[model samples]
Target: MADYPVTQGTHGPIYHICPGLRVNLNDDGNWELMLRTTDKRKRSSFGKGEEAFKKAIKAGELLALKLGLLQVEHDKERLLSEVAAEWLNLNRQRWSGTTHERYSQVVRDYINPKLGFLPLSRINRAKVREALTETAKIRAAKSVELVHATLSGIFNEAIDLGYTNENPSAGLLKKILPPKRKRNLTKPDPFSLKDRDLMLEAAYKHLPGSYPLILETIAFTGMRLGECLAMRREHLDLTNNQYFICESIRRDVIGSPKTGDRLIDLPEYLTKKLGAHITRMREEALAGAAFTDFLFPGIQQNAVRLMLKRACYAAKLRSRSPHDLRHTYASSLLMAHYSPVYVQKQLGHHSISMTCDVYGHWIPGEGKKNLDETLAGQPVSRRPALEVVDKKIPLVAASGTKSGTIY
Candidate 1:
């Protein structure tokens, strides 16, 4: 062992124990080992003898190198909330405003409250599942699912940044959480064809101005209220008899459409009506009306919904939501034997399964009729009835008198 110079300090003696390593005796006479390697510096105590202390320092350096902690100069004990904030800031811009707001709110309301203080490395699957289970008590299963997804996204970002090795929230939902209850598909209560006609007629009669046209457009095109409200002049092409759906409005903020852009073919009658509507809008614009770009002009979704409700009442029809008009459109298509794929594309659903899952019951097909026909060809058989009467038969006797009689 090389004899190194020991520098005396106020507490005790400090020795240059090795290259990149030091040993210091504290006021309490305990020995501490300090290690400095590349970009990292860490210190710990090694109890007693000089020989034992040197061995401890060597072992510590080897462990730190193996963990890759020797080259990384970061707080290895950073909390989950710190990493989450970084992740949200980096990724929120890619999402729509509503989606960003929703993620932020979920993180604030559910996740951060439960697991924020835990160190990133310590946030394991069990901790994540426990938090979700607790959240499920007061929030709906859907809300819990959102929380789980958000947490998983955060951990994934942490992994990319080398803050953690694994996403604790991965597969946690399936392992510990019960499946979310299926939505009650019957609740939407889509308007039937008769009800639709009656409501449109009632709207034309009872509602003022363009309210009826708005309802008609939604029913005919199956456009969502936001998309309908957000429509503009450039979106329509009368020559091609098509309308482009590239954007939607929510809370008066225009954004990309939910399922991206699509071109919808319009019926001739609708094309003509829309052309007249556009002409009227142009005239209004020239006459110093509000200089808004929206095709519907100055109408909001809530006002439209209120007018729809009154129209349904006046028409003696069951009350229907504005969304029901969209449902009515899809239902009519399916009832006419339109292919589910066609319906899915027309509705701009991201997947055909979603279209089928929601509207499968309305799609026309053989249904139970086929089963009925299969059973209809079978023959029926009947068995004879039994007859009963009071009767007695006896045989007789050792005397050979064959004397028993039945009557």
Candidate 2:
């Protein structure tokens, strides 16, 4: 046994066991590392041994450096929830309102419940994997992915702030989480042109005031339901037979359009109809009707959905969602021999591959019909260019008689 420099503590005398480290043996006979920096002290037990004391000193110094305690006092034992809140505050301005809200929900529902209490330093890859495994049990794979992403974002921000060394959620997803299954490649079931026409006609006959026109606009221009409901008179360009899709409304919060701004061309008939609807809206507004900037004035997404549901029922048609109207528009354009690039722009898809991925099968030459047509044309000759003939040749037998053989 060697004498070590010792300091007095409330429990007993603590040993100055290593450089920038101290140790105290507790009543339970456990050797605890008493970490002393310039501004604060922390205690951690790594069991009773000279070896354990040395290892604890090394680990504590590394953590202290990571927490910036070497240069200044820092809250090294921050909970995951605290880091998440800081992350949200720093990034709230960068993300759209919907995106921020979605991320907030994921943190509150998934990450906070499982890992919020854990200290930032204690949250390693295994801890994150456990959280993800638990989340996967009850949530969809996509939800689990979001949870993973939220945690990664928080830890990454923590890393940049020197609060932690690594993002535990990084790369663990592919290893521990189940691979996301491929989405079905089948073309979305949208209303046929005839069915769309029938639905529109029935809507006009059954629905009250401007609802049919709203449905018609969605079908004519591949506008999302939110974008349609967010439209104001300023968005319409009747003379050009086009409208600008620049903003959207969700839960009464106005924000940028999902895929950014785009211009959508409308048919002359649709343009005329929209013009007439606007004229009537102005008259109604002047006549003391409820005024709103929305083209569909005072209608929200759910109201529009209900209107569409009733219209479909009245049309004696299969029930279709409001989104199905957008689908109908894209499918019809693709069926009319329109190029995927054109369709992508018209629908405001972020990428051509996205448009092709969803409606590629609807493209005339990209479906089963194309395969049938390709095989129906002809079979090219694949015969060999050379021919050989069989001839008889003389061969000697073991019995010394000549035998005839084919060569």
Candidate 3:
């Protein structure tokens, strides 16, 4: 028989019974911790002091259980890897394929290998911060945020399952800031009016068949490389003068749009170019040349990039990329005074914020025109007048030369 602690019940001093540091109530109950008062009768007479000791001991037992040194009624300590697996299992079906693949890789590559040694309850905010800060140095800001978010969710799940009472990552928001991401500052070589016309002329001169038409379609439509490459014969509708953007081909795998939307329209010039390319393909097939259903098949994506690079070189222009064609398209549309919301839909952006974030800078260089148009759409009180004053008055004579007189 172990010493029982003198704890006060409602009436008076009650000699409470407990054994060792942890007492198992029979074979089935929450383990009760034991602590004896130094002077049982005296502490009991001093009022609720004995009861306070029992409460403190009970709380201590719960803390011990949470820290994984002791087991609770039914809950067991969980390994970090086990928790991560559970997290993935719960979220796998809810996330998109692209999203699920990325989260899985992050957990496997970063979180598990580094933190797997610790039990879920033992992991603390300091450990989580160290992992995230180190990852920021190696990966992009967006990736760091994603990994942090995933880990946070996992820990939250552990809390819900009673593996731990509190999430280690709960206080992380105040402790960590996402690293500032460096924008891709190098601008793509934008095509001038003359440069674009020259490239069109060269394509017509050198690749008179389908290739020229394909180039024209890409230049005018601003379709993504994968989207343009994925175009099939069945997707075209010359009578409607519209080419639908329904799918994309990535690494030769055909799939629906990343934006999850099925359709966008191509401009009439792009439609005509598609028609011409198709006509050329038919002519080439008749002349002992094989063609594919894919409008731009058989050409590797790298080859497309390389070909575009060479064209830029030939034009004596700075190196450009296939993606620049996309910028060119968006810049042109925005310059034409088309609505950003409309452009967002065409580009399949989930939010107008993304459209503005990526392409908003392009509008500022449009020489105050966009600002004026935007301001016009506002309520009368909000709209400000465009003020213009001549900063300098040139001294010109009748002969159209500078006057001899000076102030």
Best by TM-score: 2
Per-residue alpha-carbon lDDT of candidate 2 for residues 1-407, written as tens digits (9 for 90 to 100): 21346778776667654456666777776667666767767878788777676555455545545554433332447878889999998999999986887788888888876677556865677778878988877876677778888998998999999988988888887875545555222235689888899999999999987788889989888899888888888888989999999988877777888889999888999899888888887898899987666787567788888988898898889888888888888888888778889999999998999988787776655545545446756433443446666666768899989876757
RMSD of each: 14.4, 11.5, 17.0
TM-score of each: 0.59, 0.64, 0.54
What is the per-residue lDDT of model 1 for residues 1-407, given as tens digits with 9 covering 90 to 100? 22345778777766654456666765666677677878778777767777555555455445544554433433456777788888889987899865776788888888776677556765677778878988877776677778989998999898999877888888888765555555222355789888899999999999998889899999998999988988888889899888999988766667788899999877778889988988887788799976556777668889999999999999998788889999999888888878888888888999999998888877646155456446755432333346776778677889978886878
Q: Which sequence of candidate numbers ranks them by TM-score, best first?
A: 2, 1, 3
The local distance difference test score of each candidate is 0.77, 0.78, 0.65
Sum up the clashes in candidate 2: 0
Clashes of each: 0, 0, 0
- Candidate 1: where is the Cα deviation over 4 Å? 1-85, 96-102, 108-141, 162-168, 175-177, 180-187, 202-212, 297-320, 351-353, 364-407
Lowest lDDT sum, 10 consecutive residues, model 1, at 376-385
lDDT of 2 at 272: 90
